[model samples]
Target: MNFAYELPWYRKFINESDLVFCDGFGVLWGAKLCGYCIKSDNRMTCPDYIENLALACEQENISLFLLAGKPGTVDKAIAKLKAIAPNLKVKGHHGYFEKIGDENEAIINEINKFRPDILYVGFGMPLQERWILDNLTRINAKVFLPLGACLDYYTDAVYRGPRWMTDRGFEWLTRLVIEPQRLWQRYLIGNPLFFYRVFRALIASSWKNYSKMSKFWRT
Candidate 1:
């Protein structure tokens, strides 16, 4: 729900990504309007994917690692995941560390020793993405999932709203109501800017298609 625009590094990372999934309602809606073949259910946030991830890892015996969040949030998230899939092999660390300093090396060493199948990092945007890219080869994980503030949701450090509100895309509103001062810019300003870009893209796409059709007819 945050940082959909105005971050050049993030955009560059996203463009270079091999696998990209819509992480928010705004992204999903924009994709649909742009004629993508994505279903609404496919637009899952991090909290929405934890259970399925835990189950899959439990069944396949794939080790998992939670590598982000506030001081205690990763531990709380680990506990919550254990409740869902008790047999799932998982370890975690807090996301408050320097990416290029001693802290980063310590984290990489821990993760390399564990050799997790999937490493979920919730260091928030741009940072999480950059962290993975910076240490992509050093980390022995098969998959690196960037989950922004997902740990907070699992730990109840952040309220994710009820199902009904979230289903209808009012989750942003709920968040704004809960933490207005912290989230005002994200929702109030960023949300509108995101939509405006989506609308502009839709129009441009339509114009391009029409032009192509007109040229084809003339030929």
Candidate 2:
């Protein structure tokens, strides 16, 4: 019922209503394929985004409930958040506890206890999106976002591209230069595969429209 309109990045939905945020480039790109409108700050450093978020939380007194990626990452992220916004309130921040399917009660418990205004889900994309879509009905947060790699990015555990590169959409290469070990596969293999699928989807859509036009002409 809450997910009435077409939603884009989790941030837009997050700022406005009860929702969750999902991260990961491919997932966000896929949202584009689905014709959703979301703000894309491909150049944003993870810390910069969180720093502003911290300011918002402190100023607004809005509680943030975090679901961090990988084990132990949440604690580290909280520490970084505290450094950014000394007075920021993290109602609840925890590492991944529930697996893909075994997440209902765990997430619901936090929602009931914290009733956070913001729910930052750090699970990677597609997975984060799927999780939020499945569990949003049970969530109490007014906003939920699945910001992929954003946590690590914020902690400076990962490197962000230069502003100019990001503006020109060459940020992917910058990442390769910064952390090739972590990203080689994602860019070298993953991006090419994604492009293929995206082009295929576009072609298919064009063909569908052409077929419809032909039918109308015959009629």
The numbered model that scores best in lDDT is: 1
The residue ranges of model 1 lying beyond 4 angstroms of the native Cα positions read: 1-9, 212-219
lDDT of 1 by residue, 1-219 (tens): 244356676777777777887777888887887788889888878788788889999999999999888888888888888998999999999988888989889999999999999999888767788888889989899988898898898788988899999998899999999999988988898888887888888889899999999999999
Q: Per-residue lDDT for 56-170 in model 2, tens only? A: 8988998888786666667777887788688887854554666444565866786668788888887665457667877778888887766767776666666667767655567
lDDT of 1 at 185: 85
Q: Please give each candidate's TM-score.
A: 0.88, 0.62
Report per-prediction Cα RMSD to one decimal. Answer: 2.3, 6.7
**Top candidate, metric TM-score:** 1
